[model samples]
Target: MDLDLAQVRAFVLAAEESHFGRAAEALSISQQALSKRIARLEAGLGTALFRRTGHGVEPTGAGDRFLEPARRALAAADRAVAAALDERRPPRVDVWGHLYAPMRTLAQVAAGSGAPPLELGHGRDLPSVAAALLRGDIDAAFGRVHPPLPAGLTHRLVRLEPVDAVLSADHPLADEPALRPGQLRDSVLWTPAALHRLDFLHRFAERFGIRHHAEGTNLGLDGFLADVAADPRRFSLMPADVPLPDDPGIRSVPLVEPTPLYAWSLLWCGGNPRVDALLGALAAEAGRSRWLEYDPAEDWLPEPAGEPA
Candidate 1:
């Protein structure tokens, strides 16, 4: 026999309310419709389920016996529907650039807290990265956002680190405390051939109206440094985090004017659960750090459990 949840619900309500009219009203259905559903239910089980009395209604022996199981089955059906609705919103996996450091720390925290390790993806440039995000190709992205990012994407600046200008010791600007974008004009500039190059050079050039030359066809770190030292006039820029070369002939000066600071941010589409989770984790880490240094007494008030304190 195939039992229906609607029939089970009707039977429970009728049994609980003990009145066909009140049960149907509680269920927001016509009493005749409720009676028909109950009749169908009883027919499926091959038993008479209720006796209609003048005062109200009484459950037959078969109906009384089936009551508990019927209620359980209806509850299970409701839970199944709820679960289906919840599954309509699935969590997403995160994707980040190779240079993302703080998120790597957060990923470690999530792992320690039993979250699965993050997944990563790569693209040649920021526009390409932003495109992938717009197309739903990745759940979240991590990298620098020099200006306000693309309109739809949201970001949180997690960390900032200094980048230094690399030069041969004899280079004219090597000793300068900071560099203005204009000073590098007519100089051979070297940078990674990756997206970061375009982000720093092209964008900076456009923003500050500086003319510069890109060194070599493809000058990577090793080649750029080699080129810089070989030709004392040529200089390359890299993050200050790079270990200083043993060659006292080379020096790294922290650049000022356009402030050579690199920003690391977590970004995602405006509304997404995976991104939300990632942000929440990041915020928790920040809060933990902040609470340690400057504790806020008002924020940690004791909760009232049994009696008010």
Candidate 2:
């Protein structure tokens, strides 16, 4: 019997999720489309693969028998594609949150001797990156991984970066050795985009009772930081390792007492050898730098999604 790989993939995801809606979501297709694919697949096999239940779906005896082989077929297809592309080519990687400089971590990884070459690109956010990963437009991406991640993609926490408050040099709290989240409750939480689009900053503001918020045009990091420096009332959070533009007008104050950590994770579709190499190199670098270190007693993290707390 001839079986379409797309149909096979849809069946596998549906079986894994046990819910057609979620399976469709993971495939980035409509529920109706997913159902049709599976229906066609079942017709080709001449048997029902699934049975509807109150919770979602359960595999029929045939489906239970087919599951492992379907997974192998998908993996083999991925390998064929990877082989055709040529393993010598660097893995194509994209990153989100460019405004915060995700490249710094990648650059650090690349700097290590014997690290594999990488072709880097930029993505707007997690959703966009997830789409690119699904489409095979890119092999992997780096950014903050949050919930509802597309089903086929997988991620691993790479770094936990402590954040600092960016303040104008003349701000009242500027000269303090360090500031706690509570210390900035009265200041405006400056952001480059609307709070809803800036998950990390929004959560930080909500967690700390920083009520005032201001949005500015994002010309780039330099322009954004310059705007932050222009007003003493404006403050923003940034990963401590991100280098500030040389301007005496602004200062980067470490957030202490309960420091907020920005979780960085490497996300990818499985079965890429290059991605495996990159992961290993990143792991070695993280170990050397203690990049994943976290002291829960003294640090604060957003509630765990897929990312490490």
Q: Pick by lDDT: which candidate is best? A: 2
- Residue 129 local lDDT, model 2: 82
Q: How close is candidate 1 to the true structure, as a TM-score?
A: 0.49
Q: Where does the lowest 10-residue lDDT sum fall in candidate 2?
A: 300-309
CA lDDT of each prediction against the hidden true structure: 0.61, 0.86
For all candidates, the clash counts are 0, 0
Candidate 2 residue lDDT tens string, 234-284 = 899888988778999999999998999998899987666668888888889
Q: Tell me how far the alpha carbon of residue 259 in candidate 1 is from the true structure, in angstroms, after superposition.
A: 2.5
Query: Model 2 reaches what TM-score against the true structure?
Result: 0.76
Query: Model 2 residue 202 lDDT?
Result: 85
TM-score for each model: 0.49, 0.76
What value of lDDT does candidate 1 attain over all alpha carbons?
A: 0.61
Error of 2 at 193 (Å): 0.8
